[model samples]
Target: MPQLQSHTIRYANPILPGFYPDPSIVRAEDYFYLVCSSFEYFPGVPIFRSRDLIHWEQIGNVLDRISQLDLTDQKNSDGIYAPALRYHEGTFYMITTAVRGIGNFYVTATNPAGPWSDPIRIPYGGIDPSLFFDDDGKVYVTAQQGADYNSHAIQYEIDITTGEALSEPQVVWHGDGGPWTEGPHLYKINGLYYMMSASGGTAKEHREIIGRSDRPYGPFERYPDPILTHRHLNHPIQYLGHADLVEDHHGEWWAVFLGVRLTKDRYSVLGRETFLAPVVWNDGWPHIDNNEGTVSLDMAVQRLPLTAPSTPENHAAIVLGRDDFNEELGPQWLFVRNPSDRACSLTEKPGFLTLYGEETGLGEVGQITFVGRRQQHLHASFTACMSFIPVSDGEEAGLCIRRDEDAHYELGVRRSGGRNVIFARLTVRRESLIVYENETKAEQLLLHIESTEKEYKLACSEDGQNWLSLGSGSARAISPEDFVHKMCFTGAVVGLYATGNGQASKTPARFDWFEYEI
Candidate 1:
C-alpha cells in the first residue's frame, strides 16, 4: 500500500477511450499493463502498455488468434467478460471467462505483447474470473457465481499450470450487497489481505466496495461504504466500478477502472471507457479520491519522465484516423464475431478494401462480411467512400452504425430498378423499417452518418465536399435495450459493410477510405 502526492503533468480523462470496459491493470518494474474485455468482437481482450498511466499504446491483444478464442455461436453481446492481468515471478498471467462457449480460462506470456499461450480452461463455473499471487507462492482464483447478474462470488486456491484446485471452492465474500458482487481483485497490504469487488449493477448506479481478510479465502469484513462511486454525483460519467489497483515505480498507487460517458440525457454511445484515479493509503486500506470518495474528470499525478505516443485530438474529442487501405489493418479494426478469411481483404486491391458480400446481414445470428471500429465520440462524423455495382437488387454496400445484431441503423446504397439508390434502414430486434430512400447513379459515393449529441443525420455525397441529407433519427432508438431488449454491455461501432441480402455476390464492395471523427 502506498500514498499519492499531487504533482504536475496534466492529462485528459479516459486514458484508453472507447468500448474498453471491465479494466484490470498490473505494474511490473518500469512498465504498466492493462487489459479490457472485447465481448463478441474477435481478438478477445485488448492490452495496453505505458510508462506513465496518462499515455498508453496498444501493444497487442491477449486473444488475437482463432485458437486463443472462438465466439462462433455467441449471442449478440455474449463473449469475453472481465479479465485480470497480473505479473508474477517471470510470467504474465491473464485470467478471464469466455461466456458463451468455453467457460473460464487463463493465458500466459513472458511478454505482454504476445504470442500468448492458448486458452487453458479452468473447470470452475463462474464469470469475471480473477487471480492473486500470494507471498507464500500460492495462487488463488476468485469469480462471481449464481445465475443472476446479482450473484455473489466464490474463491479457491489453484495451480495456474495444471488448472487444479488446491483447495475446495469456497464462497469467500459478498460485497456491500446492493446487487451483483463481481469483478474481484485481491491484494496484500501491510500483512492484511484486501479484496475488491463491484456491485449495484454496471449501470448509472455502479459502485466499488472493498473488504479485508487475514487470508486469500476467508470470512472477509466488508467496508461500510463504497470506496469509489459516481452514483449520486449527477455527472455525465457514470458506471464507475470494476477497478484494479497498481503501484507505480515511484511507489504511488493508482487505479484504472471502467466508466461510461453519458450524454446530457444519460444515453451512452461509448459503452464504457477506461479511466484513472489517484489512491492514498488510509491506515492500511487504499482510499481513492482522497476523502471525497468520488472520481473526477481530471486527476493530478507524478509525471514519469517518458515520452508519450502522439494522439490525434481536436478541441472536440480524440480522432480515429482514416483507413485509406494503403496498409494493413490498424489495431482498432474488428469484425462482428470471428471473421472468415473470405469476408474481407486488403491485398486484393492496392488502395481499396474489398469486402466480399456475404449472405448474412447485420444483427443476424450468423457471421457477416462486416468489419468495424468502436465509435468513440458522441458528436461525430463517420464517412466511407465505397464503390460497388450490385449485380442484383439484393446486393448492397453502405456505412452501418451497430449497437448489436438486433439493434442498428444502416444507410445503404444498392442497385434498384436499374438505378442506383440510397436507403435508410433501422432495425430494433424483430422490428425493421426502411425509413427513407433516394436515387443515385454514382458508382463511388461517400456515405455519411453525422451524429449530434441527441440525433443522427444520415446523408450521402457525390464528392467528399457536397453532402445530401438522406434522413435523421433520434439516438435513443439504437441504444442497448432497444437492440436486444437487454442492457447490452457493448457499445456502438461504425464501419463499411456489404451484403447480398441472402445470396452470394462475387462482385466486391471496394472502399477507398473510411473516416470517423468528432
Candidate 2:
C-alpha cells in the first residue's frame, strides 16, 4: 500500500473520546465509517461517518429498536462487545458478540444511518466476531476462542446471506505469545491474508499483534512483535489495542484503535476512547504510528484534506453540554439496559422529562428509569432541574454521576423523616452511605455535579439561583483501574434518574431541563 507524505497536520490523539472502545473502521467510498462498543447501554454499536479520518460525527446507532436489541438484565460492560464493521457488495455488515444476550450476531443495512435489519444470529461461541468477503465471493468469519494463554484466533467459512456454516471452524493463528487473543480482524492485503488481534488483556498491557497466511484459514506466521502498543511506555495515553485498519481514497493507510488518558496517579476516568494513527507498510508487514511505536495526545501526521459538512442537515448536531427537553432525545443519550417505554416520557408533561420510578434502582441489575450521556471531559459541570415530590422515603429523583451500579454518586431529593430533603449518596463496592442531607421546603430543586480530574463536587439549589454546597467524592473511587476484573469497560455517565428503592413510586419526577459543560 502507498503512504501519504506530503505535509503534516496536527490533530488530537483520540478523535472520538469518552467510552468508545473496541473500534472498527472501513472506507465505503469517499467516507470512512466507524463503530464502537456500547456495553450494557441501550441502542448499542454507535456508528460515525467522516470525510476525513480525524473528525467523526455520529450518524445513528445500529441497534436502536428494542426488538433488535435484547439487553434485558445485562450487567455493566456485558451487552455489546467489539463490533467489526465491514462494507461488502453494497451492504454494511456489523458483526459482534452480545455477551449476556444473544452470543454472536450480524446486522446489515444498505445505508449507514437508518433502519438496520434485525440481527442474524451466528451459531458461534466467542467474542469480537468479524466478517471477511473475498474477491472470489466467498465469505469468512473470524473470532477469538479459548482462554488466557491458550487463547487464539478462529475462522470459518459462512454464507453471508443466511449465516450458515459452509466449513468447519479452524484455528488460524495464535498471537505473539500474549494472553487473551481477541478482537481479531482479517484482511486480504496485496494478495496476502493478514490477521490482526489484540492481546495481553485490555489493561495497560494491551497491544495489537498481526500474522499472515496464504489462505483464509491456515497455519499463519506470527509477526514476532506487536505492531502497535504502549505497554511499557510512560505516555499519557495507555492501554492501546483492538485496532482496525482502513485504506483511504488516496491509497493511504490509517488505523483507529482504543486508548485511555490517565491522570497523574495512572487512573483513567474517561474509559477507553477511539484514537487514530497513521500506518505504513514495509516489505509485507505493517507498522503503526511510524518508528516511534507509540501515539501521543497531540500528533502531527499527514491526512486527507479536512472536508466538514457544509449544510446544517449534513452536519452532526451532537449537543455539547446542554439539553432543554424541547424535542426527543438525540443519539448521544443512553438508557441503562433495555428500558421500558413506560419508564420515561417526553410528551407527558410537554417540555419536561417525566421519569416514573420503577421498583428497580441503579444498584440492581434490572432496568431502571434513567437516561444519561457519557462524561466527555475530566473537568466538566452537569446540572439538572427536577420537580419531584417524594411521598415515601425510598422514592427519589435527581442527578447521578454513574460509573456503574456499585460505583456511583447520587444527588437528589427524597423524603426522609417524614419531610422532603436534598441528599447526596455515594455507593462504592456495594456499600452505600448518605453523606449529606438537608431539609428543603421548595417544590423544585436544581442539582449540580461538578467534576474535576481529582474529585467530583456536588451542590443543589431550591430556587435555581442560590446554591448550597453538598459534599464531594473522589474521582478515583469511580475510576476503572480499581475494578477492571469486575468488567469495568465503561466511563462515567452524568444522568437523570428516578427510582423507587423496592416499590413503584406513586408520583413521577419531572425534569424541566439539564445542562453539561466543560
Candidate 3:
C-alpha cells in the first residue's frame, strides 16, 4: 500500500456533533455508513451516510420503534454503549449492548439508510458488540466480558441470518498485564485472524492492543506487546482506547479510535472523541504509525480517497438545532431513554416538529424523558424558540444541553402563579439548581451558551436582541462512563422540548426556529 504524503492530522470539525460516541463505520457501495452508541437516548443508534468520509448526512435511525431496542430503566448514558456496524451478504447488521435488559441485540437491514428490523436479541452479556464475517460466510461477534476486575476477551461464531450464537463464546485473551480491557474487533488478513481491542482504562492511560490467531477461534497470541500505547508518557493525555479498523479501497489500513483531551486539573469534559491514525504491517504484525500508542493531536495524514469525510463542511452534513422536522430527524437529536414515536410528531408537517409533553416531569432525575442532542465543539451556540400555553403548573417548554440527570442547563418558559415567566435553571444533580431566575416579561428568550476551550458562559436575550449575561457555568470535559461519556461523532443539537403533566392540546409547544453556530 502506497502512503500519501505526510500532512498534519486534520480533524474534520465535528461531523455529527453533540453526544455521538463509539463510531462504527462500514463501506456500502458508493456510500459509507456510520453509527454511534446512543446511551439512553431514544431512537437508538443514529445512522449516517457519506459519499466522502469527510462529509456526512444523517439518514435515519436503526432503533426508531421501541420494539427495536430495549431501554427500560436505563438512565442517561447507560443504555446502549458502543455499537458495531457491518454489511454482510446484502444485509446491514448492527450489534450493540442494551445495558438495561436483553444484554446485547443485533438489528439488520437491507439498506444502510434503513427500514431496519426490530432487534434480534443475541443471548450475550457484554459491551461493545462487534460483528465480523469471514470469506466463508461465517459470522462472528466479539465483546468484552467479566464479572468484575477479572475480564476476558471473547468471541462467538454467530448465525448471520438468525443473529444467534452458534457456539459457546470462547475466551481469546485476558487483561493480564493491561488495565481494564474492552472494545474488541476481529479481522482476517493474509490467513491470520487479527484481534484489536482497547486496554488500560477509558482515560488518558488508554492504548490499542493487538493479538493474532491462525484460526477464527483463537489460541490468540498477543503482539510482542501493544501495537500502540501511550503508557510511556509521564503526564499523558487521557488516550484511553476504543478502536475500530478500516481499510481503504487501495487496501491501505487505518484505525479509528476514541481519546479524550484534558482541560485544567483532572477534568476532561468534552467526552471521548473519535480519532484516525495510520497503521502499518511489520513482519506480519500490525503497528500504529510509530507504535507509541498515543495518537498525536498534531499528527496529520491525508485521508484515503475512499474514506468518507467526517466533518461539518461536507455536503452530506447533518445540521442540528435548526429543524424543519418534516424530514427525518437528523442523526444528531436524541430522545431520553427509548422514545415513543407517539410522543412527538415529525414528517407530518413539512418544516415543523411538535413535541407533546410526556408524563415524566423535567425535574425528576433519570426519568425516561426529554429529547436532546449532544453539545459538540467548545465555541458553539444553540438557540430554539417555542410558544406554548402551559396547561399545568409544571408544564414547561424550553431548550437544554444535557449530559445526564445530574449535569445540565435548562432555559425555558414555565407558568408560575398563574402566569408565564421566563426562567433559567442549572442542575448539577442532587444539588439544587445552581442558577435560577424568573423574568417578568421575557416574551421570547434566546438562550445562548458560549463554550471556550476552558469555560462556558450562559446568557439570555429578549426579542433575540440585547443579550444579558446570566453568569457562566464551569464546564469540564469528562470521559464516557456509566454517567459521563465523551462527546464525539455527534455534535450538540438545539431543538424544541416540552415536559410535564399535560395533553397534547395543552402542552403543544410550537418551535419557531433552532439555530447552531460553531
Q: What TM-score goes with each of the models? A: 0.93, 0.96, 0.86
Question: Ten consecutive residues with minimal summed lDDT in candidate 3?
Answer: 477-486
Tell me the tens digit of each residue's lDDT in model 3 across 1-518: 96755334454423443455577788777777888777767778888876655566788888887777767666555678889998876879988888766788888899876788887877665777788999887888888887435666788887776777898988887754666678788889889998887777765556778888888877778876666656565432456457777666667776666655555555545566655567788888877733353366544555445543445543344353455455765556677775555566665444656666766655453333365666666567776656566746767777776555556666777776777767677655425363656644554556666667555667777777687776655564222331333322322333456776443325666665667767
Q: Which ranges in model 1 have alpha carbons more than 4 Å from their true place?
A: 1-6, 148-150, 289-294, 301-319, 416-419, 481-484
Supply candidate 3's per-residue lDDT for 415.
70
Return the top candidate by TM-score. Answer: 2
**Model 1 over residues 290-392: C-alpha lDDT tens digits?**
2263466665555543334454433122336687999988777888788778879999988999998777877576777788888877789898898877778
Candidate with the larger TM-score of 2 and 3: 2
Error of 3 at 85 (Å): 1.6
Clashing pairs in 1: 363-405
List where candidate 2 sits over 4 angstroms from the true fold. Answer: 1-5, 289-294, 304-318
How well does candidate 1 match the true structure in TM-score terms?
Answer: 0.93
Residue 335, candidate 1: alpha-carbon lDDT: 84
Identify the superior model by lDDT, candidate 2 or candidate 3.
2
Q: Supply candidate 2's per-residue lDDT for 247.
A: 90
Question: lDDT ranking from best to worst?
Answer: 2, 1, 3
Q: How accurate locally is residue 223 in candidate 2, as Cα lDDT from 0 to 100?
A: 78
